[model samples]
Structures are given as C-alpha cells and as structure tokens.
Target: MIKPYFLTALSGLFLTQACIADVNLESVTLDNNPRVLKSIALLQSLKSPQTAMQFNAPYVHDLKNRYKVRSLFVESQNLPIVDIQLTFNAGSARDEEVATGLHGIANMAAQLMDEGTEKYTANEIARAFERVGAQLSVKAYRDMFIVKLRVLSHPKKLEPALGMLMEILNHATFKKSSINLILSNTQVGQKQIQENPSRMMNVQFYRALYGKHPYAEPISGTQRSISKITPLQLKQFSNQFLVAQNMNIAITGQLSAKEALKLSERIAGNLKQGEKAQALPEPIDKSSFDIRHIASDSSQAHVMMGHLGTSRFDSDRLALEIANQMFGGSGFNSILMQELRVKRGYTYGAYSTFSFSQVPGTFSFSYSTRQDQLLSSVQVAHQALIDFVTQPIDLNQLAETKAGMLRAFPNNYSSNANINAQLGAMGFYHQAADYLSQYPKLLEKINAQDVQNAIQKHLHPERLTLIVVNDQLDKTALETRLKQDLNPQAAQPLPTENLPNILNPPEKEVIDLPVSFPTDAPEAI
Candidate 1:
C-alpha cells in the first residue's frame, strides 16, 4: 500500500512504454565523464558509514491521554530539523459505499481548503510556505488523510506554515469560483482513465476481490457519484471524520519531546470530536470459484487474477512476503517470469504481489498479453502458484528473497515523506509501532515452510477470480483447459455485457477482433 514519491519511494513501478526491458543502465552511462571509481577508492572508504545511528533515538511510548493528544517527539541537538505528521481516519473509503468515489472529491476539497480563509487566500498560503522554506501538504489515502509540515526547528520557520495548515483543516472556504475549475477538470481526467482497459480491469478487480467490502470501493467517486458531490458535502464529510479520536501525531528530526508534546496538543486541541466509525464485519465466506472477466475491444487482454490475501495482522505475512518474491515478484529472475517469459514467451513480464491491508487485501497476479494467450497464461500462472505451495521452497530461494526484501525495505524509508507513509500504514493497520524497526528481523526469520503454509491457506486457486479483458479468447476452451490442468473446476463465464448493468451504466457496444501472435513476439513485460 505504499505510494510512489518523487524522492523517497518506488513501489511496483512495473512498466514504462518509453523504457524497454534491457539491463542497460542508460541513466548511468559510460559515455559521460563519471566519478572515477579508482580516485574515490584512493580517497578511502568510510571509516564507518557517515550515515548511522550514533544516537539511537529511543521511541517514547509517551503514554499520553488518548483523547487529549498523541504524538511522537524527537529533538536532536545535533541537527536543527523537524518533521510533524497528523493523520486522520477520513480517507477516501469514507465515501458512501453504493455511491462510491466521493473520497476523491473530498481530497480535492482538502487541497483547496485554503483557497481563501478569512486571513489568507490560496496564493498567500503558497507564498507563506515559500518564504519559510518548509513543505506543507494534505494528502488523501484509502483509509486515512494526512496533513503535514516539515521545517527547520525555529518558531519563525514553523508558525506561518502551520497556521496556514490549521486554516485549511479547520475553516476552509471551498470558493464557488474555484469549485467549477477543480471539479470539471478532475471529472474529465477520470473519465479518460476509466476508458482505458487496464485501468478498468484494476477497478473492477477490486470490486470482485473484495465483494462489497468498503475497501473494494473506488477511491475516486464514479462519474455519477462525483457529479452529485458538492462543496457542502465535502464540508459535512470532513466534519464527521476529521476529529481527534482518529488523529495520530508524529515528529522526527530536531524537535524536543516537550516541544513535540506541546505542538501536538496545540494542533489537535481545537478539533471537535469526529463521528465514530463502524468496524467492518468479517469478510463473507468464499464459496465456489468465480471468473469475473471484462471483455473489451483493446488489442491485448488486461488480466487481474487473485483471491483474498493476508492482512498485516496475519502471522505469516513475512513468509507470504518472501513467497511472493520467489513466485512472481523477483522481476527477471522470478519463476513466473522465468517460465512464462524467459523460456516459453507468454508475456513480456509476469509477476505477483500480496497486498497487506488492515484487513485481508488481494493477492494478485497481473499480466497483459495477446488476447489468445489469456487462458494459457492464467493456467501457467496458476500452475506456478500450485508448484510454489506444494514444493518446499529451496532454502537458497528463501534466503535470496529475504535478502532482497530487506535491501529494498530501507530504500522506501530514505525520504521523510516515505517514512511518514510507512508511519501512516503502521498506525492505521494496527501494526505494532516497531513494524519498520523490526521489518528486517522479521523478514530474516521467515523459514521456507512458513511460506508454503501461507500459500496453502491463501492460494486457493479454486476460489480465484480470473479476469480477462478480451472477448475473442475462447472462454469455454480455456475453462476446459484449466479444469483439466488443475483439479478445481473452472468458473463458468458470465455474459460480459451484463456487468455494466450493476457496475457502470451501459456504454456503446464494441466488437473485439481475434488477436494474432508473432512466431517470435517480444514478451510484453
């Protein structure tokens, strides 16, 4: 659930049409005069890593009253820095389940919250942050929203930026003039995205996997849902959910614990009590398997296949993490890619990922290829899953995946923004406070059998939701093929045209053509 940041994090950033599947390091080319490695070596290696925890800042449980305020405070006399985060529970999923996607409208409203509070206009808010050399932001997530400030540890540098943030949160005037400009452009852009087959596949996949779960709903409202959302609705939603009960405050860098406590208190003190959130009920017991395909006129089929996956709370989450990497996630070296692309040439790249959410999220395998490859590709992917679960994962494979996972984990925390995201995830998912600190250790402890067990529990390919986006693929033939390969009976196909009746309003019917494959087709990874 980590989102990409320009500076800190990159998560599952699979394809770039502009970039090809070559190991060539174009960004670090030999043609340019590069830093002479020999010269740097002669300069001598770090006697010790220049960046290390000389002073391991012990996390304070701070055991403050839950209602009054809760915040993490850290001050390093060594560096004059401060990072503060305020996270609340009014994330995008708070939108009405049936109407869907009001969360996006809420996010846009939050961005424009400071358009013109009585004291400052939108431009003034920007100018103030520019003057202070600080970053101020409000971001929306699936389960929460965040307001943050990062600045040098000086009152002069902090107050104005924080002041603007307060106005944005507490008293926002969603100016009528700005409303049309923001909403109209947003709606148009979303419309374009929904039309794309791959995007549509992903959206519909969530609806299928979660099956009426709140988390299954789209973050951005549907076309009709957004049209009905007014600024008044934004105000009302914020009022109901952005209260102190759901708020968590954290500070890092050079801020005193006392100062951190005082600041956290001040920030949360005036917010009125937010409405209580309902705990989601247990997910429905999965029944006979279902194939939820979305046939489209696109040249290639966009497939989204998966079943309910482990939660962050699952004991075997770390094991599942390792298995995911070995099975489909290790990029070129993975078994899925090795069999499907390197050996057989099914798709350019084939991969799988296990999403760890507050509740069980989707464990999905996604790949796009010529429409005809649809059935065979799913069978191949499913066979790979079966082999992974039954076989004892080689210890070397587990070790390699663990090492890779640990190495990649720190890259995610390298940016302040990225760290805050991890913090938000940890807080919201009920993950222990030490989740990040302990990530390496936990991943290291995962033995091979742990992975096999996780697979057995979660990878019931029998109940998997196999979706393919091209109508030309012979569904009947594929189902017969899958039923033969795997003992699980393949799900019967539903008439694709019927989906829009309950999901999206019906659109113009489009015909799909039979897809042709090259004798030597370049894999679509």
Candidate 2:
C-alpha cells in the first residue's frame, strides 16, 4: 500500500492535468476574434492630425554694409557657439568663364583655399583652429561656393577664427604642391567615377540634356578638364569670384543684433568688392524622346528618366512641390512607390525628384530592379507618371499631401545650424526676406487645379530622357514598349527608327583610395 503523503501528491498532479485538458482553445479564439477585428478597423479609420503645426519664424535682420556685403542674421541664445556662412555666387557653373576646358577650377580653388594663406602654413592654420576648439570649412557646389566657420561665442575664440578666415579669403596662396596634390587625387577619382554605373549614367544624361550648355558638365569635372587647371588660373578665378560684392553673409547662434552687424561689417571690409556673377543661360528643352543604355555587370538595372523642369522662381513652384510630394518625392505613400513596390513588388523603392536651382533643373524618377524586370519596371513607372498627369486630380489625396507638408515644415528650421543654412540659401537665391515666414500661407493657397495645371505644364511624358544601366538591353523590345506607353491611343506601333541611338560607355579602370582627412565637414548647399 502507498503512504498517505504520496497518495495526496499523486492526486494533486492528476487534478492539475485534468484542468489543463478541459480548456477549449477554439472557444477562446472564438471569443476574442470580434474584439481583434474591431480594434484593427478602429486603427484603420484613424486620421492624421487635422490641425496644422504653427511655426514661429525666427527674427531675421537683413542689412547691407558700405562695402556692398549683404547679410541675414538671426540671434539665438540657446547655445554658446556661433556659426557663420559666406555664400558666394562663384561655383562650378562659372568654371568655363575662367577659360575653356577648365571645368574644375572653382572646385580646385575651394579644396586649396584652406591649404595655406600668405601668412600661415596649412598645418599651422589647422592647429590654430583646433587650439581654439573652432572649425573652418570651404566647399563648392553648382550654384554657390561657401566658406563656413563655427566657434565659441566669446570674443577670444571668435576674433581669432574670424582673422584666419579673412586672411585665407584675401590671400590664399594656391601653392604649386597643393594644386598638384588635388589634381593627382582627382585623377584617381576620375577612374572611380567611370567604374560607377550611376555616375557614368549621370554624366551621359547631362551631356544629352544640356548639349554644350554650361550646366552640362558634372561639378567634379572630367580628367581632361581638371588636369589643365593651374595655380595661377585658380588665383585668377578666386580674384574674380570670391569677393565681397559677389557674396552674402549668414550668422546665427549666441549674439546680439548689434554684435552681429559689427561682425558682418568686419568680414566685408576685409575683402575686395568684386562684381557679382551674371545669370546662367537657361537649358534648352528637347522636343523628342532621348534614351540610352549603358552596359554594367551588376545583376540589377539602374534606370533614370526625366525632362527639363522649373526654376526656383517659377510661379508654379509651390504647386509642383505639392504634386511631387504626392506623386513620387515623398516615400512609400507616393504613387510611384505604391505602384511599383506595394502593388507589384518589382523594386525595393521608386522615387522622383525635382532640382530647383538658379536655372531650370531636371525633374527625374529613378530606381533599380533585377535585370530581368527592367522592361516591365520602366513601362510601369512611365505609365504611373502618365496617369498622374492625365487623370483627374484626386482632391482628397492632394489635401493629405499638403497636410503632410505643413506638419513637417518645422524641421526645415528646427535648429540654429539649420536656420543658418536657410538664411544662406535665401540670401544666395535672392528669395524675399520674409520668405520663411510666408511659406505656409503660400503653400496653403495652392489647390488641386493649381497642382494639375503645374504638372501638365512642367512634366512632358512624350519627350523624356531615359537611361538604363545593365549588362545589355533589348533595344527593339524597349522601343516597342516605349512607343505604346507614349501613345496608348494609337492604332499602330510607332516606328522605332527615330529613337536616338543607344550609347556604349567604355569601361574604366578602378582605383581605391583611403580616407585620411576628417569626414565631418558640412556639405555644399
């Protein structure tokens, strides 16, 4: 016979097992199913915030000094640091003005500016800034070349940093060794660019679109152009472009209005007042479709397509901005992403963008997909654009797009550094002094009709520039699909003979370079 304690233990174990076995799993699921579906429906009906965000525009003091130096200053007492940017009209677009085939002079000048001044060596200047915990940088872009300084607000730090910047601005040596070093590095870069499928396609795209226009060349320039740049030529380019009258000042961080004004005056007084750069010629819009295919070894095809777009000052800019946000520029929710990624699963992402600059820029859409899916992806993406332009404007979606923009507008000037950038851009592009404050109101004024009209005016689906990078392309098949996409109403397939000849890009040598300098410098605006 078992002991009484052992019998009690066995009985308790049996009871526990019986209770667990009696639980009806199906009944539990049946009871919770209604609640789970209801919760999902409730979540699906939830809407984005209806109220627009209020943005308190910072006080911008716009003033010009006797030396003709324009300035936009914003006082922020949040941090002990001060940030200053000098935006000059001199950029890569003006390279040809220095001399024909000298496409990289402006870029070379920027890279060498901090290498040395007449009074200081490059290492000495670097040590001086490091000792004061200050930072100095110079960069070049398509429309502007900028020099920036960040230092403590105290006069001890600010004064020394300012002095060094002034010296460099007035008397950058552009020494022979420095010039040779930059050119040597650029030569290595040329080989790498040729190896890059995307970069090669961009070079070809600009060449095809702008044809002999100043904007046709990439800012990095070709090897032939950069190798010809000399130290004397760089100095001449600097003397002509980097002067007081050709640039504007932007100051932000801890400072009073009076102090800021004085600082601006001192900077302006140190440089010679050269004339401002003239306007860039407008890019000619093409009437026919231009398509090219580049050979690549990658398994995925990199594709880009677009036509000439609007300028920064276009009357329909706000409308186009909203439309682009809805159609492609914004991620995931954009029509292109929805069609290509969510609906078809042909690509990881599909994006479209507009480059609003001093002159008209490209309105482009680009993506990469498996090589086998290239033709279908191109056709589908093109069809989406066509539908967006030809179909009736979806007022509800437009409202959502504008709401998203208004809600996200605060990030544009959320920090002192960001505000400084905005001020610099406004001053460089000649935007109205009150442009930031009036952004929301102007954006709200746009309606569905405005967006529709702007899209039709700016986007020409019939005349597009198509670029594809893959191992090979079926030219005859792609032409047939493009003809159908361009003329859906046509009873017959359009002739493919008129399509521009495909481009065969030559292979380039690959070279790898190690990074030795700091990578934290600010990018050119």
- Deviating ranges (above 4 Å) for candidate 1: 1-68, 73-79, 97-105, 488-525
Model 1 CA lDDT for position 365 = 78
lDDT of 2 by residue, 30-65 (tens): 356764443444443355455433578788888756
TM-score of each: 0.78, 0.83
The window of 10 residues in a row where model 1 has the poorest summed lDDT is 516-525
Q: How many residue pairs clash in all the candidates, one count each?
A: 7, 0
Name the weakest run of 10 consecutive residues (lDDT summed) in model 2.
512-521
Q: Can you write out model 1's per-residue Cα lDDT over 1-525, one digit (the tens) per residue?
A: 654473243322444433435433334443364653444342343544664432221353342644654554434455576777777766665676323445466466556666766667888878888998988777665556777788877889888777777777777767677766776787886878657775676677777766766666566656656666776776777677777777777676666666777777777776776655565444553664566767577766667677778666788877777777888878887887776666555566666777665566667777766565567667777777766777777788778888777666665455555555555555555555555666667777777777788878777766667777876656677666556556545533321221122133223422221112110001100
Clashing pairs for model 2 are none
RMSD for all candidates, in order, please: 12.9, 9.9
lDDT of 1: 0.63
